[model samples]
Target: MAVATGLKQEQVVAAAASDNALERLHALLTEDLRQVNALIISRMESPVPLIPQLAGYLIASGGKRLRPLLTLAAARLFGYQGDAHLLIATAVEFIHTATLLHDDVVDESDLRRGRESANSVWGNQASVLVGDFLFSRSFELMVETHSLEVLRILSRASAVIAEGEVLQLITSNDTATVEADYLRVIEGKTAELFAAACEVGAVIAGCDKQACAAMRDYGMALGMAFQIVDDVLDYSAVQAQLGKTVGDDFRAGKITMPILIAIAKGNEEERAFWNRTLERQEQEEGDLDHAIALLRQHDALDGAMDRAREWGERAIAALEHAPESVLKQALADVIAFCIERDY
Candidate 1:
């Protein structure tokens, strides 16, 4: 399928293959990431076997470790020399993993990163408890940083992420949800953590207020673009490449950008279709296919992609005053990778 970005899926894949900005960033941060990984493994250990086992299942799962990487990269961009970024990065990953565990239970999802989700294998009770453990462990790591500012940033992000999840729950299955409500949900649940991750890096590095704000802006915009594109992919063939079930959002009756745009542009019949399948939760086998068709017919997917690109541009523009360096350029490239990645 052609993305709303005017690139065919094959073209998107080829472009991603050729440029591969994420790979470049990984190469730059190889040693730092290794230390972060080691710290993560050591911190996750506990006398309670289930805590480590369940947490390790998801932690060892094939995640990109993107959030923690952002923390490390942001610090390095300011020429930070301390090992504190390593601890902060590990703490960020724990927070993220904790959220994922809670999310799978809430979504009642069966798959995560293409495998059986922690909740699916370990059950909801175990998943929630382990998630709490991870959250507690994350705060412990944060306290070790000895920076009250870092604690405040990450703790506030944790609260905001919880708020965002609650907001999403409120909006889910409600076809009447507007674009603004959707943006609020994503900004709280998704963008806040990304913003905090980057901001914490700068805070620990003692960056000037202006520089700290710039990194925060870059992360927030990049996160918004990241999530918008992820929502778009739910109806795209590319979701399969990520080992996700296509139409999982539609199946769950979650009101995403494409659905919202389609409903706005749709005829009465189309609106009723949404009401029946989404609001009413009366999905039949072919409902997902028909929903995709409507999205295409109304150019809803294109509209959503357009919004994603707008956010991507904003992320890049936020870096205008950043010092020119290979790491800085790689960070900019990451914005494109977030928007254009096929898998």
Candidate 2:
């Protein structure tokens, strides 16, 4: 199907090829991500030391660690040839972990990566406190880089991310929330960190402003695309791949693209069902299946998928301003993976 972004068939094929090449890029960066892991594990400490145990429990539970991997890939793409790549990579992971800790609390989530969430297992108090420790540790790692620009990039992202989380909290079940509002929230909460991840690499590599912006744009677009696809998967992916149930967003009262569009285009009876089941938060056992049917009726998932593809294309376009290298190719491949990945 042709998505609204109007990418050519070859572009889609190229994106698929890029997605396949991730195994090659993963092999290339295995050592770098491992170094980042070591640094991250070494720094998960506090004077009181309660943080060490709580943080360890969450961090040790395996995650893809994609944000830091993106940072490492960006540095490699620019031929950084320096040890700071690992430090910056660790910093990005710290930032990501901190957010996850906070996000579970905000979303009242029970499971993550097929296990109990930190907030569920360790309690919200420990999760919140440990998340603060990780954020502080991330700043410390940034200071080790001794680049004012890198610090600024991360600090601003952190602030924006906090704001995004707050915005989402306030907008829950708000039927008035539009697509643009959704974009703003995800751009701040999700994309800002991604932009900072790639931008920090350019700063570490001593790239000029233009190069830094290029990487930043690539990260932002990729992150946006990634979240949109994730929202779509909440409806489409099987429970095993998603590590969560279908209609999870509906339960959380967050109106994602598919839900929003479906609610808009559904028939009178369908709209009333959504108002009763979703807006009222009174979903019966069969409500999710009916909601899924509504999405199919409106073709909302396809629309959301198309929106994700547009963001992916924009992410690739952002790479045009970057210096061509294997690293850049790897980053491009990451963007492609964001769109094509089923989980």
Candidate 3:
């Protein structure tokens, strides 16, 4: 089910995007990630058995756990020498998992991380309530850290993520959605948590404001790059590796950057097609192919990747402000994984 829109995963990851970045990072952070996993499992437990069952369903499903890894890696970069990084990393993961539950409910999505989404299995109400439980559990972890700053950073990120989700809801199915609007939505939804994840790592390490800012910048840039690449992959990647089926965005009428660029650059006939498929919700057979054709004709997906690359470069540059360490270099490698994964 790879979108045969004429762009293959091989074509997309041809040059800049390297899979080794994640592998290297994983190897570098193996022990710390193991601890984070144990913390995640232990914290997911609740008196109510359903909570752990539903949470465990998705938790056991393989996600790379990249955000928590970022937290641990950032803390390690600053020579943090305590167990707090482990706790904070687990908390960051809980926040992310909560968002995923809510997002699947919002999207009415049946699939997640290449399997049945939690919402699909447990019903939306269960999925949402469990998500809330995870969020609450995360705050408990934050309280255990006893750092007001860490709590403040994560709480703000949670609020921002809510705003982003709300904004995306408002804009969904609107072909008129603009690039600025799309970027803003992703900033709130994707990048804010990433920034917080890395920032909290630095905070726990007692890094100064400058080092904290550097980690934030790195995370933000990587998040932006990661999201844009994901959007492109919706139309250009192997469906097996895409975490969701191809053309899910288009079918949902959720206007993404590729669609926006095409709308801006396409001719009148092409515009009508977008309006019918997206705005009018009048999709017909062959629409995915046609959408892909328009995107390819306009080179919109390629253009979107270029923007992702620019952000990746910024992510790499942000690392320079932090003191050099193997962890820092691993974070840099994450930038490559963000940008160049299956184009």
Candidate 4:
């Protein structure tokens, strides 16, 4: 169950304290999310038992299951009561898992959720193959949904995700990657799937075009906030909570928000460090600290987080057409939590 992630009611309330109605909505959304998670696990395919080893390893790692939750919650908000929601929810989870499998490979990440990553435990080859398996499996499940419109949205989202991965790869280590470029990459990589999740839910509910569009906009804004926060975490979060070292992005040659902002504002010495560290991928013993200090000195991390909050507020505003209900309020709360949560 999605609830198996051990999301506490108190945590949700604390996460949503700024808005009372959202607390109630989060409670219901959590329950629906549990059902969606079960569906995802049950539908995941592993013809060879060994294949299941890595696939199950990652699937059972206790992610927040936000993507699937968004799908079910959006459908529920529109009064959908069909099993199609379950199928589509699983599809979303599969898509998300597939991305993670590939991401760990690309990032060479050793840890996730405080545990060894699948690539670390099972090997990169297995991780890549299992990731391919999940991607194909997601498409197969999408085909089973039988809604051409749903299929179209998911297919296009999948394509965009791949393109985003490629874009990030090309832009990696390039200090010239500005805010607009970073935004485009995250929108395609992260927000497109989110937008698709909400869109599919609205489609399943037969929602009007205006409401559907609203949900899409909400998802896009939420995802933008989500990615920005993730970038911030790379700089601000502790290793225990971040599940990685503070300067992991710089080590990986990825020019994230904090680094980009820092580069733009850095002086001659700081710019030289960035060039050698990122451009040359040569990190001396103290380079990480230097990068972190630069980010803090310029307030890039906090600035990016402020931008995330702004996007979260815009997301709440996009929900104006949504009915005044606890669920609507909770959707807004999730966006706020995305911006504020430590881990």
Candidate 5:
């Protein structure tokens, strides 16, 4: 699959190697996407060389630009005209990138998109400060939109994303975390921006409240499914295919849904194993293999994927009231793409 713009062919192949619907969506929006990329490049410029260097490096890291793609797709689906969507799209991208930088620093992650992370290449301090710059730039882009709701929506998302990261920090190293707590973490860290991006697409399109609600619900649900699958992939995917080290979450003691499921169904010995590895963070080599085995034995991975499928279904249902178009179908296909990620 030649995924969206801004991805290398190899990365695309590794990810959605044969997803035709995703490719069609990318092809349909090619011209508008070109404009979005131009704005992103221009806005990233800074007098400070390190800021641009680090920012540009991560920005080009070629993960799915899914958030911005959703913003653009949503706007067009609602018949948005004018170039305002371009600015909003770029702002969404900046916000997402800033969070990735902050996340890598906090996670002490060495790899991103199958390459050395910015925090690894530059220092943590540099990565953190530069993330701050990009975050500030996001607000500047939002302010240019001149829509209070747009500002309100994205500003709130930015705040919630920070809170989510903090919440994940609080939940780390604790296997006792429940499913609801895990859901809250993903909502704040991952889904809030996704919801805002799509909701703002309606804002720019001048759509009514009903359409806006539909867009927000669609994005939130899709984002929820996306993050669940992402956590599952951390434990199940090839590290190179995923563009990050597999078991990173396990090493960091992050309490995700799979672990929660396994804990719910695991025997006493399995529970102790989880507590030692995830709760106490007393992990050693071969611990990850054992953890994977436990998850499989308990069928936690299947349960997690089932939960993801439910959310993906909810996302499609949310879009039912929207008008029919190729864009609408493409957006639906995007939900399928999110749920079906194997890379």
Candidate 6:
């Protein structure tokens, strides 16, 4: 499909393939990102040593900061001039960091961003408490924006994210989960924050309702595409390039898109394998390899990637009418990057 600016899906993919789109965006928003980083560091401070110590570990860990970058770029796209975007961007990062801390604890994850996870280093209690502190700090930043609309968008996203996590917990290890259920889980957990982050930028910029809605749609679709690609990489990417082990999802019994598709396409024997490995959590030495084989045998990886690209197309389409600018083009290219990135 062609975007309002006449950019086609293939063109977006071609642009992403030719350049480091994310780096280009970071270069454009270098100053704003610097300010956002400074605000994050300043707000992370506290008299309690462990609070900052633990929170700082995860916050300073290598992350792309894509959500906050979206906020900054979106505001710039709409001609926002004031510093409110900085505070909102900082808040967006804090919220994302808090979710990471909590997710590590929930997932029993020992590593994050290729390093020891906060919960692994500091224990679950401390991680959970620091996550709470960051959540509170995020709200404080939102309040600083003084836009009730921004507060509403982010607060509701926070709640929805929690709900999504709970839903995932419910569906975990259950091979019967339909695609719709998985979509809802991701929409709440991941896409909601992305949507809120971009929408907050538009709202703070005093954009019209239609512009705000467009940004929200862009973010939500982008987030969906991003998470789907992430799930695909867990099974398809090389362990060295993937940052984490390739079979972490399999070990955890998480039912991602590849697994769901495999289950749907497999025969009775394959379903039995899933039951034994995922539902019962009785994985043997070569179970991961077997699982990977099943995925490939059924073309599950390709199927999931096709779904991701569909979301990427929707994301690009959402910004069809956005003013043609470097930032807008960067936003469009990032959709392709999210879908095409292997690591």
**Best first by lDDT, ranked:** 6, 1, 5, 3, 4, 2
RMSD (Å) per prediction: 6.6, 6.3, 7.7, 4.5, 4.6, 4.6
lDDT of 2 by residue, 1-343 (tens): 3211212345434444543655545555766766777887789866877788778777888776778877877776777778887888888888888999999998889987678898998899989988998999989998988888888998999999999998888777777678888888889889899889988987898888888998899899988998988888888856546566677788877878888898778778887787777667877888888888888888999999899889989899989977655556667777777787776
Question: How does candidate 5 score on lDDT?
Answer: 0.87
At residue 300, give the lDDT of candidate 6.
Answer: 96
Tens digit of lDDT per residue, candidate 1, span 9-52?
44334434545788766767777889999999899999999998
Tens digits of lDDT, candidate 3, 299-331:
999999999999999888888877655556667
Q: In angstroms, what RMSD does candidate 2 have relative to the true structure? A: 6.3
After superposition, which runs of candidate 4 have C-alpha atoms over 4 Å from their true positions?
1-26, 237-244
Per-candidate Cα lDDT values, in order, are 0.89, 0.80, 0.86, 0.80, 0.87, 0.90
lDDT of 2: 0.80
Question: Could you give the candidate ranking by TM-score, starting with the highest?
Answer: 6, 1, 5, 3, 2, 4
lDDT string for model 4 (4-30, tens) is 122455544554554433344546665
User: What tens digits encode model 5's per-residue C-alpha lDDT throughout 179-236?
Assistant: 9999999999999999999999988999999999999999999999999999898888
Clash count in backbone of candidate 2 = 1
Is 5 or 6 the stronger prediction by lDDT? 6
Give the range where candidate 4 is weakest over 10 consecutive residues by summed lDDT. Answer: 1-10
lDDT of 2 at 299: 93
Candidate 5 RMSD to the correct structure: 4.6
Q: What's model 4's lDDT at 248?
A: 68
lDDT of 3 at 262: 91
